[model samples]
Target: MRALIIIDVQKDFLANGFLVVPEGEKVIPVINNINHHFDVVVATKDWHPASHKSFACNHHEREVGEIVEVNDLPQILWPAHCVSNSDGAKFPEDLNTKVIEKVFEKGTKEDVDDYSGFFDNGKLNDTGLHDYLQSKGVKEVYVAGIALDFCVKYTALDAKALGYKTFMIEDASKGINFRPNDVQNAIIDMKVSGIRVIHSRELEKVFSGDY
Candidate 1:
């Protein structure tokens, strides 16, 4: 069975939100439409604490997008976003959440940042997403969501490494960094790890037989 893994499609990633991804809002319709064709739909949300170490607000010298070494891991300091119980953490109002079978809350710990839905940065713990999908007998996963160079890329890499046939729908993802060739770099990385990259409109052709 195949599943659609929607990562961090939250209000905070929208145009008006704290840490908006460029053109992030454009992916919603594509995600909503493809969700109907999948056997299972799972979503991930960034549920962080206000004082989470990943936030630039918590680090005096760092600014948003500044990279720092934390616990020997390269961490990007972001503006405080997706705080649990806050409006920014909520799913985008237009996202079709009713069809999502499982909603995974990640990055809640004050010390660790979980960019991938599969595991935390240090691989300290599982998000339980992989096991959950396996338990449901899911063999293939198609990933879509905000921040293509971060969450979306890491999730796809982890999924592909775990032996799932993973595909990343590029049109359904946006980059927060807006770095030169970041999207292209992510595509190259995904391909190197054996993950297929495609546009949302090509899903029908890529995953045939009713998806």
Candidate 2:
């Protein structure tokens, strides 16, 4: 079966948000338009605690964009975003969430950061996404969402690692280019790992079973 795994489309990643990705809002319509074409659809959320170690606010005079170590893991300190039960953590009203079957919450552990929808940064914890997809008989997964360089990229990589035939929808995702060429490098990494990068338009006929 085919699945569309959407990553971190929460309010905090939108325009004027704490960790906005460039053109993140643009993916909402694209995702909405194609979600029905899939056999199943699931979403992921950041769902961080207020004091998550990845947030700069919890550190002593530390600012966003700073890198720190927690539990021997390197972490990029971002502005506190997607705090659990907060407005920032909620999906925007305009996003078509009715199509989402389940929402896997990540980064809930205050001491760890989870960039992938499937696993934490340490790869020590699983978010149950893989098993859930397995239960749904998903063999091919189409990944799209905000921040292509981070959450979206990691999710796609993990999906591939878990033996799913993975594809990344470039037109249905946006990147957080915090540094030069971060997006380009991420795409290359996925390609090296055998993940196909395609545009949403390319899937129309395939999804409709008319190809």
Candidate 3:
């Protein structure tokens, strides 16, 4: 079976978000159009606590976009956006949530940051996504959503690492582009790591189920 992994389409990543990704809202229509193409649909959320170390405000004088060391991990400081119960953390009303069978939350651990839906940055802990997908007999995964250069890229790499055939839906994912070429570099990283990067249009014939 195949699954669609929608990564962090929360309000904070959208146009008026605290840490807005370039054209983040553009992914909504693409994802909504292709979500039902798979047998299962799952989403990921950036559920961070107020005191999470990845937030620049938590550090003495660090600013957003600065890289800091946390628990020996190189953590990129971000503007506090996805606070656990905040409005910014909630999925947008435009997202088709009814088809999402489950949602796996990440970045919950204050000590470490989690970019991938499957595991924490250190790979010390998992978000139970792998086990759930395995239980559902999903051998292939199509990943899409906000921040293509960060969360979406990491999630796709981790999906391939976990023995699943992983593909990144380019048009359905937006990039934060901290650097001008972040999105391109992310695509290179995925390709070298054995993950296919594709557009939504190509999926029609490939995943042609009655879904």
Clashes of each: 0, 0, 0
User: What C-alpha root-mean-square deviation, in Å, does candidate 3 show against the real structure?
Assistant: 2.1
Model 3 backbone overlap count = 0
Model 1: CA > 4 A from native: 209-211
Best-matching candidate per lDDT: 3
Off by over 4 Å in 2: 205-211
Q: With candidate 2 superimposed using the best TM-score fit, by how many Å does residue 133's alpha carbon deviate from the native?
A: 0.5
Q: TM-score of every model?
A: 0.96, 0.96, 0.97
For lDDT, candidate 2 versus 3, the one ahead is: 3
Error of 1 at 169 (Å): 0.7
Ranking of models by TM-score:
3, 2, 1
lDDT of each: 0.91, 0.92, 0.93
Q: What is the C-alpha lDDT profile of model 3 across 82-185, one tens digit per residue?
A: 99999999999999999999999999989899999999999999999999999999999999998899999999999998899999999999998888899999
Better of 1 and 2 by lDDT: 2
**How high a TM-score does candidate 3 get?**
0.97
Model 3 regions lying over 4 Å from their true place: 208-211
Question: Which ten-residue region of model 1 has the weakest summed lDDT?
Answer: 202-211
Residue 78 in model 3: lDDT: 91
Overall local distance difference test of candidate 2: 0.92
How many clashes does the backbone of model 2 have?
0
Q: Lowest-lDDT window of 10 residues in candidate 2? A: 202-211
